[model samples]
Target: MTGHDRAPGSRIDTSKPHPARMYDWWLGGKDNYPVDEEMGRKLLAIEPRIPIMARANRAFMQRATRWLAQHGITQFLDIGSGIPTEPNLHQIAQRTAPEARVVYCDNDPIVLAHAEALLRSTPEGRTAYLQADVRDPADILERARDTLDFTRPVALSLIALLHFITDEDGAYDLVDAFLQGLPTGSYLMLSHGTGQFTPKGAAEADELYKNSGITLALRDRHEVERFFHGLELVDPGVAVIDTWHPELGEPVEGQQDFQPMPGFGAVARKV
Candidate 1:
């Protein structure tokens, strides 16, 4: 990782479940608590393909980051960066553009704790982590500037994040705020969880999270597309997560078996 400041970890709440921890649990990681595993397993029972979806989502991120890096976009600002998974944003980007610089932000203290130890940057590249929420775009931008140059283009990644943010929380406005601070050449690369494929299961999952004191606002295709209203979407616009640039990705088991994958993914440019 780069020399960016690693803020001290906040108290981890083991009382209830956090989406990040549950995600870790699904990915076969041991950083989660019993509460997280309980909820994660319940959700898995509802949608057994979740583990497949999670792995496919990571593959999409790798493809998107590689697309950006190969296109000469060297800086990245990834918000809602969950637990430090393997082949992280920097590792993917720096593979093509060795000088790539990345800034990963997340509100969970667990991400900061593990990211600092697990996320490694190439000798020619840099990586940094910020313990912050996506709602605080100004603060994130400020801290990100320590490693990335805002004057140039950056790929603002919101993969598998916005669905957790409700419209009441100003999801669109939050995205606009982040994009506003970036230049014309900048991009918004995002993947959103959706209920379009199976509304009943999605509703059950949403209700379960609400009962667990978590917000799960799964949007449909049109609503997800609305996030990129003012921007220009890349080719095969807003395709299913696994379908977007599949040639750039390796074969993910069950990816082809599952039609549509219950989410949308896209990469759009400011101008």
Candidate 2:
């Protein structure tokens, strides 16, 4: 693994909220700051199911990682990986396939600060973390090559990450670049926030994020599927986050009681 690129004693911006920190708060983690808590609480006020959605999103990550492991996919490139929670991507993959290799990348300095928890790997496997952004697909792909074999099938997960990237930022093109860099049989796994179910509420959430200096690129189901262009979507093609193969893993508590989270998730093969 390469050395930590970020300098020690980095100043974490506690004045403004950040996605990773807010997500950490939503997941009931302590790595978040008060600013994050304030924003998360506001979001909850807007949508009471925010925490459930976070857990549901996390459940998707776990199930998808397990599926990839069982399907003989031993390499993972998970970008936009938020603050580490227990049984993270490596934990799930390594449990099913001890030899699975995982490389996690995120632009957040806080993620880098807590990256030690993410680096612990089983003796038979490997894990690495990169301090980078999703917009720079080439850098991520090039660095991931150090731990992952691009020649083989890899599950590239962008879970709950794309909403932060907008069209003007070349979101689709970045995905295409990453997919293009991988060999055939590689998979693209993603979960994206959408405005489909509740456009007004979603717009309000977007406004809040915008005012807080965050970007929420909420897309509809069709637009989210566009990121998988040319790939063969797996069974149960892009549906609400909770609908993608609920049978594969334990259903999130109260997930069925609430309106489907305004997000879609799917896994597809490059073919």
Candidate 3:
């Protein structure tokens, strides 16, 4: 179910712009191709602070993980895990709680190629990788169950990922399936792109991604909150990514002057 745990040099499509590789380019990583960089550059032209937005999104992941770990949630199931970013979800959670168990899942084979770096867990903690799509909730849950104890509460993180999933693809259904599979007290954490702040820029970016064969399903604040339905949302419910729990982590610089990077982030308990 892991990248290294699979056949070597397996299915990797370099033709299209995948979420993982494009995300890598956004994070200034060298794992992406020229196509990804081209698209990323286009996005940057529209939103100059894209790298800052990426960092803010990543910081949100870390803070949310830390909050969950501090609240007694030691297991994590992170879907749509992009290219191996430093201080990944596992690192943040395990750092706070040494015994944290993390399961990283992504549909991209390129991410699988670098899954080893993600697997480097603390001796007291555990980490595993799964090559799967977020749409396949049953398979992810089944595979993650091998490494995580579903009987206990888990922190499900979909950071900067759900935007790639369009409504036609049942984004809400996928979330519900995963939440339904988890026990009570489990948590659902997510940061998604939105168009509320800059509609024109968001539209341009969406068109660019569409031409590149990628889906950019940016949702509004209200729509993003739909994913947390039936769950008890934590404080600062469904705010811009940088605004949510800014006290818990370092704030993204120059964020105050910008046009409010259009995105929504929140963490909710599955009661």
Candidate 4:
């Protein structure tokens, strides 16, 4: 369900699997229900290294945050912020730059339920959470201004988020809308699932998600890169998530043995 449709205190759906909850299950978090676990297991059967991939994705977020913070960008707007796994985007950013300000937006009620963990910023930093979806960029940007300064540079993070939004859903248009509000030097950090590695398995996974009433738009490398059309890519442009910047963080164990995590990640500047 989209965030606009769900009101505050809305009941969490326990019948079907959700992408956020399933991701939490894959990361070994205890906040997921049986339905999430069932789907997680099913996905695991399809891609046994999904847990490793999840860890790799988290590591990518952490490393990207560090890179942004190190480059003097102290404000962040992370959309599609999933369940707060430890060392979240704010924590990583504030660790590098204590005065950093962050605004997190997510549509999942489950994420809102555990948002307390995401709000614990350092005394010198600030963090706020908004229960909003990526589809509604205007509302998100308006509310985010309470915590972030729109006139200044703000890093926009969309890690592991766009694969759920298909081309028909205006993924590129939504990104442009978000970037349009930010100033020059603002960054867009993204990591999206791709079908380049194993086309057959990706197709099967898409079918499974489609049957479960979820959209899984696994794009190729070229299509994924097109999301950053006008933005200037950072060094090592659009590499596999794990290979983006290995020097920036420790490697996820057994990541090298896997099939490159079936994704692409990159950081780019708006200028």
Q: Which of the numbered candidates is closest to the native, going by highest TM-score? A: 1
Rank by TM-score, highest first: 1, 4, 2, 3
TM-scores of all candidate predictions against the true structure:
0.97, 0.96, 0.96, 0.96
lDDT of 2 by residue, 205-245 (tens): 99999999998899998899899989999888898988888
lDDT of each: 0.89, 0.88, 0.86, 0.89
Tell me how candidate 4 scores on lDDT.
0.89
**What ranges in model 4 sit over 4 Å off?**
1-9
Report lDDT (Cα) of residue 156, candidate 2: 92
Which pairs of residues have clashing backbones in candidate 1?
none
As for TM-score, the candidate ahead, 3 or 4, is 4
Point out the higher-scoring one by lDDT: 2 or 3: 2
Residue-level lDDT for 227 in candidate 3: 97
Between candidates 3 and 4, name the one with more favorable lDDT: 4
lDDT of 4 by residue, 115-232 (tens): 8888888888888888887999989899888888888899999999999999899999999999998899899999999888998889889998998899999988899889899999
Q: Count the backbone clashes (under 3 Å) in each candidate.
A: 0, 0, 0, 0
Residue-level error in angstroms, candidate 1, position 47: 1.1
